[model samples]
Structure formats: structure tokens, C-alpha cells
Target: MSSSLRVSPFSHAEEIDFIQLVKITLQRKKLVAAITVSAGLIAVACAFLITPTYEVSSVLRPAAINELDALNRSEVYKLPPGEALTKVGASLESYETRLGFFRANPGFFKEFEAPGRTLEQSFEEFNRNSISLILPDPRKADSLSAYIKLEMTYPKGVDGVSILNGLVNYAIDTEREQIASDMRVIIKNRLTEIAGKLDAARANYEVDKEAKIASLSELDNLRRAQLQDERKALRAQLKTLRTDRVAQLDEAIGIAKSLGIRKPSTPSLLGDSERSPSNSVMRTEINNQQIPLYFMGVEALEAERNALMKRKSDDFTEGRIAQIAKELQLLEANREIEVLKSREKEDLFLAGVQPLRAEEARLRNLSIDMAGVKLVTIDRPAQEPLTPFKPKRLLVVVIGIILGFIVGCALAFIWAFIRNRQSFYRTLPISSSGAGATSLDGEPPRIS
Candidate 1:
């Protein structure tokens, strides 16, 4: 049983030889150098073809406390330096603010315009790529300083310095205007509130005045009615007294005529037995009883009755009637109600409104010119950069050379590998049956 070992090409294991590859790469140094030089030249050309971009930047810091003193002192609106700085930073980052600046200054942004892009599209691209708002990192210690950096990069022909400075100014102005507008709104609302309070107070005053007048008038009317009733009663009593006096005088006259008395006579003038038994119609036995009307002679009684009938008013006889008449007269005018109704300055009567009026006046006279107010302080204004930031020619050339050298070495190794494989195949011996020869060890040959 004699078996021959056959060595197939697939059965040979290949091993890497770095030293060989290095030798092959060195042998093809000229080709590597040529590729590197070509790549360097291409990089130079690319550097020249690319548009140079220049950057302009500005640093913003919090405004001084004195700069914002006026606004703070107004008491209507108060803004701190740190808060103002934050607002300015927010405005700088606002897309709407940038767009508004662009729209206002179309000539300054002319360079951003391209053939295929509209003005809006160009602005969008510029805003996205060229504009940068760098705020302090909150994680770092420097964040305590609270600074904002605004940067704008533009092509060579574009005025990046002017654009950056102008944008910063625009942002500051926009923030100032917004603050002023807010203040105005606050003042307006405050004034409106004060006015409403004043109106309410005035309305309330009017209502109170009317109520007081009605109360006083009603009181006067009630008092007058009472006095009128008293006066009527007194007058009726006086009239009844007059009528009773006339009746008594008439009876006394008749009795005096029946007794033949023609003048005033005392009871003692009558005879003791002729006292008419002390119970006659002209006299009374009871000591508490009033004197009889017949005691006066007929002539005197007739004269008294005539005088009573001739009297016009009993008011003079009664002092209370006179007082009641005076009181009624006074009630007819109601001086308190008259004074309340005739008042022209009703505001003076409203209590606790002095402070409100003073506040309203202060708000009305509030003179705040926000234009002069500084919202943010510029630490470093944008300056024209002499050198372009992009398209570093030397660095680009060096990188291109390195990449070309790497590619050239790879190509050299590949070519050397192909040549070695071909030479190995040619040197292998073939068998009589046109097959590969067998190894003497009866194992696959290792390829190195």
C-alpha cells in the first residue's frame, strides 16, 4: 500500500513577512515620492481654490451697576446687571433678531447671496454656519463670570468685523427696546389700575353723597312732619280753649243778667244767705272747683268774650308753638343735604386717596430714556482679522503627503506580493501527470 502525498496550492498556508514588505516598499521609493508630490500639489491647488474665511469675535460682559442705575431708581422697573446680560445674550442667539438685522441691512449681507439660493435661504445658511454664540460652560469655574462671546465667520470679501459689530449692536439695541417696551407696558397698566381705583372711589363718593343727601332730606322731612303734627295739636287745643272761654263768658253773662249784676262783683258782695245756697248755678261749694263764670259781672264777661273772639293767633300766647314754627322753618332747607348736593370737589372728600394720586402722578411723570441705557458691556469689540482662519495651506499639504505616502506603500506591498506569488508558482515542479509534486514529508508546503 504505497500512497503518494499530493501538495495542492490551497493546502499551502501563507505567512506575513513585514521585513519583505519594507524592502519592496523601499525599492518603489520613486513611485511613492511621485504620488506624494502629486497629492501635495493637488492640496495646494485645493487650498487656493477654497474661499478664505475670516472670523470676527466680540466678548460681552455684564453692564456696570451705574449704567443701569436710572432704570433701577425709577422704581417702576428694575433690572439687574446679570439679568440684563442674560437677556442680551438671549437676544444675540435669537434667530428672529438676526433675521431682522439682515432685513434691515441688506447691503451688508450681500455677499451671502448665491445664484441658486434665495435671500432667505442664504441667510439661513449663513446663520447656521457663520454665526456662533459661545456662552460660558456652566460646568466650568469660569462660568461664574458669566460672559458671552459672539463670533461670525465670512468669506474674504465679506466684512466680518463690521458684520459682527453691527450684529452685536443690533442685539443690544433690540434688548434695550424690549426692556423699554416692557417698562412702558408696566407703567401703562399701573396707570390704568390707578385710574380704575380713582374712578371707583369717585363713583363710590357720588353714591355716598347721594345716599347722605337722601338720608338728610328724609330726616328733615320726618322732623317737619312731626313738628307739623305737634303744631296742629297745639292749635286745636288753643282753639278749643278759646271756644270754651266764649261759652263760659256767655253763661256768665246770662247768670249775671238773671242775678241783676251789671258789673264785676266779688262773692263777698253777695249776702251770706244770698250766696245761692253755695250750690247755685253761679257758685260751687267745693274749694277745689274753679270760680264760677257768673262771679264776673255781665259787662266784664261780655267784654272778655268779645276780646277772645277778636284775637287772631294763639301762637304768641304759647312759647312752644313759636319754637316749633322755628324748627319747621329750619327743616325746610336741610342745610346738610344742600351742602352735600352743591359740592363740586367730591375728590377731596374721598379718604385714603392721596397716596394713590401721588403714585399716579409719579408714574405719569416717569421719564426714562432707554436709548441711553446700557444693557451689556462690550469687553472686546470685533476687529478685522488680518489672517484667514480657514484653508491652512501648509497643514493641508502635509496631510495630503502623509495620506499619499500611506497609499503608495500599500500599492508597493501589493505589487511585491503579486510578483512573489507568480515567482513561487513558476519555481514549483510539476508531476508526470501534469499535477503538483508531492512533498517529501507527506505534508503541505508552508508558503512564506
Candidate 2:
């Protein structure tokens, strides 16, 4: 018994025949051509109808060293050209900065305003899509290759070039203002610190001066007390000496009257026994010693006693009394303490204050006009582009034609498949065993 191989028609359906596909496409040439032409015409119309978007780009480089020299020379705050460039770039990329710029110049972005969109929505769209910052890739860039590129896109009728240039300038100005404000704060803080130090120094100086004055006053008081004591003692001594001289002269007068002697008498004149050589030697020896007051005559003793009694002020008798009075007078004033108290400019005497004052003055007098300061160098300014950046007419039409051709080919194949399956069903015969339908020639139907 020979077994017949049964083949299913749908088995070949998964396989593609290019010739058959071509025939099917040719048969539907009108439909394909219609679709292709319609898509190309639509694309052309869209290309013309869509708004043209223009791109404006600008490059930012580090400022020249000379441009930043003034800032660095401030000594209070310093910023390098590269850092300034970085700051400006950061400002350009900042959303707040962009929004600020947008709000500041509403007329520039007036085209972005629409009926349904709020200003915030407009800005969001602008910030997300319209602005782009291109920085050098860190992995491929060197230190000296640092730069930033700013690109802006806008539709026709918008001044993209002016907007780009204005944005760059605004970012630079914002960064410059920030730098200047930071420097001013630093200077103000330093000035405040200097003022505090000066106040402290003055306080300390005042304390020291007061201490010195107190010490000098104490010392002068002690000196004055000593001088007063010495003066009192000298005056007492003079008074006692005068009283003793008066007593001695009175005693001498009594002795002279009792001895019946009227003149200053020596031992030899007193008696004949004292006239010997040995007595004369004794007299000479007695003269060498302090002589007795009775040896003076009554008249001379009385006159001396009278002068002693008449003496009122004995200051001339001792030179030390005059010196003590002079010293006491000097100590009463304390010239050194007086000088310290009368000083008008105490800052000059404080240590380390001259340099601080000079610095404070310099900082106070510091005036930096950031208006002329350049934060970044514009390598290339934004120029008006002659051509639009988007909606390329030829490319769009070409793509549309290609897509339409593909779609037309797909539809042609689908219609061909439907027609072939319907014809196969119409020609199919019923099987005797009631299993399935088969072709009239006892062969499986094939898909055309």
C-alpha cells in the first residue's frame, strides 16, 4: 500500500515570494501611487506651513587675566578668570537665572505666550527645550580646554540672535554682581572685625592707663607722706635745738656772773694754777673739744640767746627741708599720669593698630566698578542664521514618500492575500471522509 503525502496550502503562507509581491504591487499601482503622492503633497504642505526655527549659538571662554586683576588685587576677595567663567556658565544654565531673564524681558519672549499657556508654562517650555548649554566632555577635555557654548532656538519672527546675546550678557552681569556683592560682604565683615579689635585694644589701653594712674597715685601718696614726715621731724629738731641753745646761753650767763667774768675767758685767765705749761696743754686740748658755754662772756651769750628766741622759721637752717618741700610739690601732680590722661590720640599708642587702621581705610576707600569688569570672553557672538534649523523641506518630503511607499506595499500584500485565500476557498472540494476540504486535483491548494 503506497501512502500519499498530504501538503497543506497554508504551510507556504509564512514564506515570502518577492516576485509575487512585486506583481501584487504592480496590480495595485494606482492605490500605491495615490498614497505616495498624497503623503508627499501633505509633507510638502506641512514643511511650508510649519514655523521655521532658527538657532543662535555663542561660545564663552575664560576672561583675560588683566580683566580680573583688579578683583584679585582687592585682597579681601579674589577670583580667577577661569572660575569667573565657570560661574557665568553656571548662571546661564540655572533655571532661576533663565526665569529671571525671561521675566525681566517679557517683550523678547512675547511669541512664547499663548492663550492656554501661563507665563510659568511658557518659561518651562522655553527652559526645557529652547536653551542648551554645551560643555566639554570631562573625559576627553584637558584643563586648559574649559569652555561653554550657549545655544538658543526660536521660531521665525523672534529675535534669536539678540536674545542669545542678551542672555549671555545677562548671565555675565549676574555673575559679576554676585562676585561684587560677595566681595563687599567680605570687606564689611573684615571692617567689622577690625573695628571690634580696635575697640578691644582701646578698652585694654584704658584699663592699663587707669591702672598706671592708680599705681602712680599710690606711689605719690607714699612719697608725699614720707616727705611730710621728714619735714615735721626737721622742724621739730630745729625747735628743740633753739630751745637747747637758749638754755645753754642762760646757764653760761649764770656761770659768768658767779665767776665775776665779763668777757670770753680761757682756762689760763681763770686762775694762776692753770698758767703752767701742763695747764696750757690741757687748755689747748679742751679747746679741741667742745668748749663749755660758761666760757663765753655774759654779753655774747645773752645776744645769741636773744637771736635764738627771735627766730621764727628755721627752714634755712637745713637744706633738706627745702628739697623735701620741692619733692612733695612735684609728687602732688603726678606728671606722668597727667600726660596719659590728657592724650588725645590713644590709638597711636596701641600696638598693631596702625596697620589695621591703614587696612580699614583701604577697604573703606575701595571702589570697584563691576560695570567695566569682564567675567567671560565671548569667542563668538550670536549671529543671525540665514537658514532655519528645523522643518527641512526636501528631507521631510523624501521621508514621507518612503513611508507612503512602504505602507502602500503592505496594503497591496494584504489585499493580495485576501483575494488568494478567497479563490482557494471557492475552488476547494469537500473530502469524502469528512476530514477536510482538498483541491480538485487531489493536491493541497497553494497560496499565490
Candidate 3:
């Protein structure tokens, strides 16, 4: 026979092989159909087993205009004192101080740390003892801490998300109000300090007034007494001089009278150009009147001298007293002015300070605001399911069917390769039986 298209020594009849292939399909039809049906049914089951989730959302706005203005005035403008409400720095500083203490002295951790025998134990203890939050807790899941990891997933298409967002917004607003509260305290403190200083200044002025007035009064009294004494002394001296002058004049008049030879002629009351006394008695009486005139002249001179002393003393006292009065008036005026200034600063201007009063005011305001927050609610979110979301059997089966088909094809190729190996002998360097040597087909030649 020709080399081309000739039958091989091991060749099988083509029709018979065709018949055998048909027989195989007919026999395995049930198995293939069963596998395909199982795969399809499993996929349908998997599709039905999935879980659905919902989402929520919300929005936030910045602080109100009036609130921002109040804060700006207190923190930036440095305006005079006013009644703008604000927050205190007490809590902020306290928080910082706590953080500092923890950072610098980690030993403080010893007392506060979770009690446990090992690091892992301690971590668990801390989670159980110290940690509290609104999210999924790890300790709640037994195997999650060891083998599985979890995360927080934000869901979509839900109302409760809005509630959470609103809560966050509210927390931010609270912080803003707290800032203002601190500003209020700072300003209030400044106002208080200024007020105290003003009060002290006023007190000093009052004390000064009392001392100055007391001294001035004593000095005035002393001056007045001295003037009186000087006037009395001058008057006494004048009176004594007048008496002596009168006596001396009387003696001279007597001597004159004793020497009289005849009575002096006297003018009558109607015509007083000349007068004479006809008897010794009338002449002596007229001469004695001249002694009274001499006494009058002496008394008048002494009175004039006393008046000058009194005038001089009064002039000195008035000048000194006036100076003291001027100084006192100036101090009083200054005190009044300072009081007015203090009032204006406290009543009209704003000082950014943190005060207890500011905190109280802020709390009251928050009370009003929190009432509004309560109205906002989370209506929709990822909810629990009527069906579980695990074990996707249908998809798993379809994948298994495809994998089985691929494996079947590989088995068919492997069978063909084995048959080819047996036919081809010397081309491939393989032995039927040897240590560390093997035939291409996974069969040992019978130990012939």
C-alpha cells in the first residue's frame, strides 16, 4: 500500500469510533444536564441571597452673623466692655493641661492603664474598660480582632445619614459658641480690673480730702485765735496809755488852777466865740475837760495799730486756705472724671474675655439650640434584612461548572498524550521502568 492514507497497525475502524462517540454522548447526557441545571439553580439562589442597604445625609452652615460679629469685637477689635455673650477658656486650658501631663509624664499611664498580664490582654482590657463610642466595637466580634479586619462603610440612599451629619454640625456649632464664650470671659476680666483700679483711685482721693480738710481747719483755727489775741493786746495797751495821759493832763490842769489870780471869763452857750469862768470851781472843771481830750487822742492811735495787726493776720490765713481749697477741688474733679470713664468703658464697649457669666449665657443659648437639633432625625439608613447576605451558592455553582468543563478538556488532552507516548518509542528518552526514570504514560510496563 502507498505511504499516504494507509492504515496503521493499531488503527481502529472510523465508523465504529464514530458510533462509540455517539454512544458516550447519549450515556452522559443525564450527568451533563444535571450539572448544568445544578449550576443555573445555584446562581439563581445566590442572586436572591444578597443584602441591600440604605443611606442618610445632612448639611451644615457657618456660625450666625451676630455671633461672628460679637466674637470679632471681643477677639480682634479690642473694644470697650459690653454685654456680648461668649465662651470661657477654662475647659480648653484644662484639656490642654491634661494632654501635657500625659505627654510629659507617661508614668501617669501606670495608674490609669488597663490592668492585664500581657500587651494583648491589656489592649483588650482597655478596649473593654476605657473605650466607648458610637461605631462598631471590635470586642463585640470574637474573631474580628484576630483573623478578620473590619471598616466603617458610608452608605447611600438613607435618611439616618442626615441625622448623623446634623449631629456633627451641631457639635461644630457648639465649639464655635465655646470660642465666643471664652472671649466674653477675657473681656469681662479686663473690665473688672479697670473697675477695681477706678475704685481704688476714688478711695485714695477720698482719704486725701479728709486729711487735707482736717489740717486746713486746724491751721485756720490757730490763725483766727492769734489774730484775736493780737487785737486784744493792742486794745489793752491803748486803754492803759489813755488812762496815764488823762492823769498827767489832770495834774497840769490842777497846778494851773492853783495859780489862778481871778476867775476866768466864760462865753454863754448862744455866743461861744469866747468863754470865761468867774469862780475857781468853774475854771478848774473847764481845764479838766482838756485832760479828757488828751486821753481820746491816745486811745484812737492804739485802736488804729490794733486794726492793722488784725488785717495782716486775716490776709495771711485767707491766702493759705485758698490754696488748699484749690488743690482739693482739683482732686475731686479728677475723681469724678475717672468714675465717668470707668462707667463708659464698662457700659458701652466690648472686651473679648472668658468669664463664668459667658459660659452660663452660652449654655442657655445651647439649650435653645439643642431643642432645634432634636427636631432633625435620621429617617433612612442601612437596615437589617429579611434575608441573609452570605453563601452565594448559585454563583459558586456556575463557577464550579465552568471549572469542571475546563478540567474535562484537560483530561481529554492528557488521555491523548498517553496514547501518543505509548506509540512513539525511541523519539522520547523515557524508560518503562527505572529508579528516577519514568514512562510518558503513568503506567509501568508489566514486569516482563
Candidate 4:
């Protein structure tokens, strides 16, 4: 019922002239064919004349963070950073290679770096400045198959040479854009990671320094105890010497009294109080009962002092008396001095070690606080290919030929339709003997 309604305005009698259309298309087939073939050939020919380009790439892993113990932390205390410090340097170098390969040639780099730096420094600075990551384009893929196909594809354009130049420039520019960005991201992330590690090391150094300070204080206390013991021994030896000398002095006095020699009442006889010794003729006035008067105390100390200036003062009985007297005075003075020294030792014991300990503490803490994170670098380097890696001519030619054949088939099908052979109707003619059906109204079917 729907088919009988018929939607189109045009009558079946006014259908297209298939044979006329066939004649027209047949006449234009050569033109279309010529143009298609020429385009395919031009594309194939362009591949040969393009300037060849090469690429080289380098890969690397960034360093990892090191776990630190106290002892290991100490070694770097106040010490300059080691090779691990140069990771940034190494990373920068990688960036330069990646960016430089894409950015510009080596000659421009040399010229730019000629001032204010040695050849090496200039190179390092250049690498630092030029290093960057090139990101990949979403549309441009580098799958193994894609790469292989790209390598095999033919180039196409006007004049062949023009297309080849365009392809080479495009490839270089595309590489600069895509690879550089990806490498930059990798490099940036690696540098940030290294920085974080360094921060951790610095924190460790702080803790280590505090521990060292505590240890140093404990050592100072130990040393103070030992020094006090030594001072006590020196005092004991001095006391023993003083007692023995006093006993000998008493015996010397008894001998002089028994001999009936009276000592001078005044210190002049012994030259105490800085007085000169009396003349020998005056010796009779110094009797046995008075023998101890001149020699007992301060006078004896003076005599001792004078006698020490004479030769052999300690070798003889008389000289021994003077020596003992001098010895006694010195011992007394030393005892007093020792009293003061004990106080000073206590003061200085910690005084001497404390500052040094503090400094050590500070340095250790600095190391730990600095946290010994060594830098790690990751990189993608610029590459020079050993062979031209692009524009596969053979593959391009094959594809173009396949496309032409498909087009040829389509054209053949279209031409066949346009020809519209009448044999189709002749072979299967409609049976005109059947009765024509009437509409529901029972009159001839009204043409719509």
C-alpha cells in the first residue's frame, strides 16, 4: 500500500537518461585517470629528493634517596657535597642534549657560550639553559608499526622537491615540539625529587648534632673527675715531704745545743729579715740554751733562701738545713696555690670542652638538618640517527597503487550503471496478460 502511494513528484516516465550519462562519463574517464595517476606518481617521486634527517636518543634513570644512619651522617658534617650533589648538573646536561638537538645546532651553542666561561663551563651553562623536555603530540604516534610505516611511506607534493623539503622541516619541527616536552616533564619531576631528598638529609643532620653534644658533655664530666684525682695525689706527696723535713730540723737543733753553741737572739745570726750574718768573733754570745732562737722559724726560712744561692747547698749538713728550710716555704706556698687551682680546674674542665662540644654539636646538627639526600637525575638525550628514519617511498607507492585500483573499480561500477543495458528488461519481460486491479471504489485506479 505504501509503495503504491509513491512519494516522488517526478513521474516514472520522466526517469534519468542512463545511456546519455554513460556517454558523458566515458568521455571524461581519461581526464580523471590522468590526474589520479599523476598525483600518485608525484607523491612517489617526492620521497626521493627530500633531504634526509637522522635522530639519536639517550636514556637514563634518576638516582634514588639514600637512608641515613648517625655515623654516615657524621662524615658529611661540615664537608662539601660529593658527586651526588652533581645530579642536578647531570640532569641539566641531559636537558641540554634533548633541547639542543631540537633547538639549534652545535655551532650556535658555541657562539652563544664564548664569553665569560671556559669551554667546559660554557658547555655546562649551555646544557643547563638548554635542557628541556619535548612532549609528544596526541595525533602523532610512535608505535613500532607506525614508525616502520612512516619510514616506508612515500612523500607527495607539488614539484616533488617542494614536498620533500616540507616533510623534512615538518619532521624536525615536530620532533622539537613533541619529544622536547615529554623530556622536560621527566627532567622537572626528577629535579623536584632530588630536592626533596636533600631536604630530608638536612633534617637528619640536625638530629645528629644534638646527640653529639650530649656525648661531649658526658666526656667532660669524666675528664674532670680524673683531673681531680691527679691533684689529690700531688698534694699527698707534698705533705709527706714537709713532715720528713721537720723531723730532721729537730735533730739538727739538738746537736747545736749540746755543742754549747748559743744561737743569736736576733735574726742577724741566721740572716732572717734580710740581715747579714754576724762576724765569727760574735759567735760566743750565741749560747746552747738560745740555739733555737735564731733558727726556728722565719729566720730559718731566710737562711734557707740565701743558702740555696751558694754551691752544694743541698749536699752538706749546713746546706741541708738551709735547703729544708727553703723547701718548707715552697711547699707551704704550693699548698695554697693548689687550693686555688682546684677551683680553676673545675671551672676550666667544662669551660674548655663545652665550646668545642657545642661546635661539634652544631656541625653535626647542620649535617643532619641539611639531610644527606643525594641528587638523582633522569634524562632523555638528543639523538642522531645512523640512517634516514622517515618517508617510506616503496610503501607509499604501494598504497597509492592500491587506492588507484579501488577507484578504478568504483568508476567501472558507476559506468556500468550509466550504460543501463536494455537486455535486463528484454531477458525478463513483464507479463501483460494479467488483469489490471481496480481501486476499492471499483473504478480505474486513480493516478496519484
Candidate 5:
């Protein structure tokens, strides 16, 4: 026979120690309550200490007929509407632009002061706390749009409306002055370019006319010289021919005298000499043969000489040359007239530009008289706000109460965990058995 091992299912079913945990938490209730109440009260006090902020906002839109549009319409060139205003808005939005404005107006910094801090740091804080820009559409976000809203918040120490209005005026004037200056510069450059072109055209026209007249005059002089030379050569050849003919006639007369044939009607036909015509017949033949063809006799020569004289006189006459000169003069006059007309056109353009320049000058002083840019106020700053901007007292109190209860519960649970751990160690049992018996960590003996 052998002893068998017996196991009970109820041995593993220990009861939970919730009652002990409750007892430990109850023991530390006073400590948890003190911490919770102190935290809640401190949070409430801090909330009250924060200064309440007040807000004032204003809206602006482009004028129906702004100065920029009017200027563009009147001038030969056009500038986009609201361009200058948009640029001004951007500048006003810039950190540097604001800083510069603050620097210029040192009094503006009095309302915003952070002791022991540099001006720049104070200015940055002031901008963060006091200014905000509201864009209607995120997609079309630009200073160029007229639908931008500006909001300013300042402490009760300063007048928010006065400050905002003053800044708005400053922005408008600065932008107008800048645009006017640019317009003046553009007009000046255009005028300079036009004047240069006109002067160059006039110079070229004058030079061309003078060159053509000089060329034509030189050609006429060359033709006259050629005709004079030819006339001189013809007169010399006619004189030489007449002298040769006279010498031949005299030789024939001497031969007749030598033969002792005075007043002979004709030469006898000698058997030893060839027969020839008489001196009178030869003289008559000379007069009849080639003299008329070459010299045209004395009367004809005088008539030819007279004709040559007429030709020479006609050559010096200024009829055709005068006509050409008159034509050149007319052309030069027409060119001058054209130049004058072109100058008139330029002057007209400049005339249009002049008024614009004067308008620019006027705008430099930031006058509203000349149209360029205009700002219309949509909403003015509120004189008094209905409620404080932030730090709701009731909300702060509620948050503090809820946070205190949670913190109290957490402290109570932590106390329960520490107390239960100590009690559990105290209540643990120790076992004693025979040498051969196995401890709880060892294997149990087997039975068959």
C-alpha cells in the first residue's frame, strides 16, 4: 500500500486585497486634499494676474476713382490700378518699415515699453502683441488687394484710433510721394531721348542738302571748261588753214611773173610742160572747192564766231543752275519744315508730359487734388469693446477644479500602492518540513 497525493482547487482562489488598499488611501486623505486645494488656488490666482487685452480694428478698400487710375488714364503710358497702394501696403507690413517708422516717431514707443530690453526687442514684442493683418482669401494673398483688414491692439494707456488713423495717413503719403518721384524720372528720360533724335535728324538733313548742291555745282563747272577748250582748238585750226592757202596763192603769182606772162588770160599749153589752170581760175577754184566747207568764207566765219560767242554766253548763264539751286533750296526748306513739324509733335508730347510732371510735383507733397491713389475707410476702430479679449475667469476656475481632483486621485492611489506593499511583506508565511520533503520551488515526489 502507498499514500496518494491530494490537491484542493480552493487553494488557488485567494480573495482580492481591495479593502486594505481602501484603508491605506483613507489614511492619507488629508495630505491629498491639502495638495489638491493648494494647486487649484494657485492656478486661479495666476489667471487673475494676467492683464486683459483690448482690440480695435479697421477695414479699408480702394476708392471708386483712385488717383493711380486717373494718372494712368491721362498719361500716354498706363500704370496698373492700386499698384502703388499695394506696394505701400507691403512696405507697411514689413518689419523693417515698421521699425523705421518707430524710429522716426520716438513718441510712439512710449506706449510700448519693456524695461531692460533693447528697442528692437521691445519693438518686436510690440508688433506681435499689437498688430494683425486679416486676408480675406488665402489664395489671393497680396498687399495689392484692397480687401485687407488691419487690426491694432494697444493697452488702455494709448488711444488706439488716433494711432491707427495717423499710421494710415503716413502710409498713404509715403506711397504717393514715391510714385510721383518715379513718374518724374520716367518723363525726364523720355524727353531727353526725343530731343536727341530731333537734333540728329536736323543735322543729317542739313549735311545732305549741302553735299548735293556742292556736287551739282562742281559738275556744271566741269562742263563749261570742256566747251571753252573745244572752242579755242577750232579757232586755231581755222587760222592755220587760211594762212597756208594764202602762201600757195603767192607762190603761184611769182611763178607767173617769172615766165614774163603779165595779165595772161590763160597759160599756154607748151609741148614740154603739163597744161594747168590760170592763177585766177585756181583762186576761183580755191574759193569754190573746200574753203566754203571748212571756213565758210569770211561772212560765214563771222557768223560762226558770233554763234560760238552766243554758246559761250549761254554757258555762263545761270538759268538751269539757278533752277537746280532753287530746287535744292525748296528741298532744304521742306526738310526744315518737316523738322519743325516733328519738333512740334515732340513738343506736343512733352506738353502732355509736362502737366503730368506738375501733377507729380503736386503729388510729391501728397496732395489729394491730383488723382493717383485714394483710400476709403470701410470700418473705423471701436471706441469701446464689449468684453475683454482673453483670460476667461469662469473657464479658468473650472479647469483648476477638474485638474485638482485628478491630481488628488493620483496621489491617493500612489499612497495605497506603497502601504499595500509593506502590509503584504509583513503577512507572508514561512514553511518548515522534513529534510526529504521538497520546498515550493522543488519537484514533488511520485507515488504508484
Candidate 6:
């Protein structure tokens, strides 16, 4: 039952007209051969007429970030080599650079362009056909160690080499300028920052100085008040001492008068006061001797008081002196802080700004002569290629022949099918009638 259900639809069909199809195909054999031969000839002519392309390449090794670190001795502002190369690659691959290339050397590139090609068209064509930047060892990509293969292609081997070299040089110069510009911009920004910091530092120093000055002024006020109080007390004591001295002198003179002492030969050198005794006079010599002795004691007391006054005049209040000394220390301390800030400013410039500036200046001053340092090393220079890299004549001809045969076969089959269609339709009625007569019931004939 499974076998009967699996019967093919063509089981009742007549045999295929293999001989007639072969004869019809043979009649078109010349056309098939002509198409195939023409295709082969065309392939050969194209292979010969097409301009051969050659690739001229150079390997470049960029400078390492570690080298910059060695020069700078710090990593505060170090730029990685990979990052730098990335910028260079971006510049090299940029559309603007390609346009610039064509614009700069119109005469050289005109040979590569069609007669009516605009600069934009020329640029696009050049980008597609002329230049390529290849990174060898993609898996081991390190900016410092990775090699850049700068390749160019042209019809002429010499032209390929020359153009490749020129492009590499141009890319190096442009990238160096770009890198230099980047460095200058960075340094300029840093300098601006430093300037702002310097201003802030100065402002802080000034504010602190003012506050300290104010503090010193308050201390000075306290010191002055203390000194004034001390001076006032000293003056009061001095006045009392003067009054006592005067009273003692007056008493001595009175005693001398009471005793009726003979006037000294000096005639009262202390300005004798000849006032009469307040009470009855004592005319005894013992009283006379006592008057002299009292005058001597008063004289000694006056001398001692004068000496004390002189000593007090020469001395200063210790508290006030101590406060002044402390003020000086405060001033000196502020001065030291300002000095330190100045030194720090200088250090920041040296450590942060100066190195980057120097690098910028060096890059800015760079000429084509120093391209080697700014750009990567040229490990392998472009050499004139000896042979063409594309359009292998034998391979192209083989492909053309294969396609031509396939097309020829398809055409032959189609023509053969068209010629056999009428014959096939005429036989179909007869076969259907025969099948109906041979069937027993109303069922269709069984497929063998």
C-alpha cells in the first residue's frame, strides 16, 4: 500500500525525445562555440588592456609613551602612544586629508582622474584606489610596537613607490602638526589654570595677611591700654614721692630754725626757708645736731626715690613687650606661608606646565627634517614593485570560459524544450484515451 501511494506522476508518460533534443542542440553548436570563443577572447583582451596595479608599502613604528615618561619623569600628563597613533590614524584616514591631498597636488593626481572628474570625485577615487593604511599583527596591537603599513597603488611601479613615500611624509607632517597643536592647547589650558591658581593663592595670602594684621592691631590696642595704665600708676607714685620730699625738706628747715643753728657757710644750699618755729624754739646744741641728722635722712630718701623713677622710666611692661614679639612672629609666619605658596606655584609650573609646553614648542618648531621623531620609524621603505598584483590573465580567462559554457547550455536546453512541446501535447490525448478504455471500473489506471 505504501509503495502504490508513492508512485511517481510521470509513470504513464511517453519516453523522452533524447535523440531529437540532441539533434536540435547540435544545430546551435556554432552559436554556442562562437559565444564561448568570444567570451575567452574578450577576457584575454581585457587582461592585456587593463593597467596593472602595484602596492608600495612602508612599515612604521611609533614612539612609545614610556619614552615620554622617561623625559618627564612623571605620569601626571603623559599621553599614551596608542592614543597618539589613534589620532594619527584618524587624521590619515580622514576625508579632509584625502581632499587636501588632491587639492595640493592637482597635477600629479590629474593623471589618475578622468577628463571631467571634479575634485570631490578625484578625492573619492584616490581614497578607494590609491591609499591604504594597514596595521600588521592586529592581534598584538600596541601603539609602540604595532607597525603601520602605508600602501599605495598605481599603474607605474615607480609612481607607486614615489606616491607612497610622499603620502607617508604628508601624513607624518600633518599628524605632527595635529599632535603639536593638541599639546599646545593642553599646555595653554594648564597655564591658564595655573594663572588662576596663582591669583587664588595671592588672594588667600592677602586675606590671611589682613586677618593677621587685624589680630595684631587688637593685640596692639591691648598692649597700649596696659602700658597706659601702668604709666598712670607710676606717675601717681612719683607725685606722692615728690610731695613727701618737699614736706621733709620743709620740716628740716623748721627744725633748723627752732634750734637756732648757725647758718652754714654754704648759706642753705637746699634753699633755706627761714620760717619761725610753729611753737617755742629749742636753743640746745643737741637739737641742732638732731636737725642736721633729720635733713641727712630726708636727703637719702629723695636720692633713692629719684633713682627708682629713672629705673622705671628705662623699663617696659613685660606683657606689652611679649605681645609685640608675638606680632612679629605672626608676620613672619604669614611671610613664610606666602613664600611657600610662591614656591609651590613655581613647582607646579615646572612639574605640570613646563614639560608640556616644552614638548609643544619642540613639536611646533619641528620641520620635515624632524619627521622621524614626530612620526613613526620607517622600518621598510617602499620599493618599486617588479610585477603587477592583479588581473591574472589565465585565471580571468578560465572564469570567462566556465560562465560561457553554463550560458550556452541553458540556451540549448530552452530551444530544445520549445521544439518538443507540440509533439508532447499531441500524444497526451491518445495516451489518456487508451488509459480510460483499459480501466475496469470508474477508477483511474493504476501507476506501475
Candidate 1 residue-wise lDDT, 276-302, digit = tens: 455444544435556677878888889
Q: How does candidate 5 score on lDDT?
A: 0.56
Each candidate's lDDT (Cα)? 0.84, 0.85, 0.40, 0.42, 0.56, 0.59
Tens-place lDDT per residue, model 4, 141-217, is 66221110011112121122222223333333443343335444544565465455545554564455456555555
**What's the true lDDT of residue 411 in model 1?**
82
Question: Against the true structure, whose TM-score is highest?
Answer: 2
The residue-by-residue lDDT of candidate 2 on 250-282, one tens digit each, is 988999889876777766657744455354334
Model 3 C-alpha lDDT per residue in residues 1-448, reported as the tens digit of each score: 2121322323442433656544544555565556556655655656555443322222222223443344343342332112111111121123333243334444423433454455445334433433222322456765331111111122222233333333333433454455446555665675576556556655665566566656666665666566556555655665566556545645544543454312232223213323543334322224433332222333343444445434423323244445544554544334444444455334222233235346535434432232222211122323333332234445566676775554444445455445554654323343234432334444333221
Q: What is the lDDT, from 0 to 100, of the residue 279 in candidate 6?
A: 35
Q: Which one wins by TM-score: 4 or 5?
A: 5
lDDT of 5 by residue, 282-391 (tens): 33221233321222233433444445443423323334444544444544334443444455444343322455455545444532333335534344544556655656
| Worst-scoring 10-residue span by lDDT in model 5 | 284-293
Whose lDDT is higher: candidate 2's or candidate 6's?
2
Please rank every candidate by TM-score, starting with the best: 2, 1, 6, 5, 3, 4
Query: Candidate 6 on 284-366: residue-level lDDT in tens?
Result: 23223333533444345445445545553322433444554555455444454455445544434333345555654554453
Q: Candidate 6: minimum summed lDDT over ten consecutive residues — where?
A: 1-10
Give the TM-scores of the predictions, in the order they appear: 0.78, 0.82, 0.39, 0.27, 0.50, 0.52
* Model 6 alpha-carbon miss at residue 427, Å: 22
Q: After superposition on all CA atoms, how large is the RMSD of candidate 5? A: 13.2
Which is the leading candidate under lDDT? 2
Angstrom error of the Cα, residue 292, model 1: value is 5.6
The parts of candidate 5 lying over 4 Å away from their true place are 1-50, 65-67, 82-85, 138-146, 223-372, 375-387, 391-448
TM-score of 5: 0.50
What RMSD value applies to candidate 3?
14.6
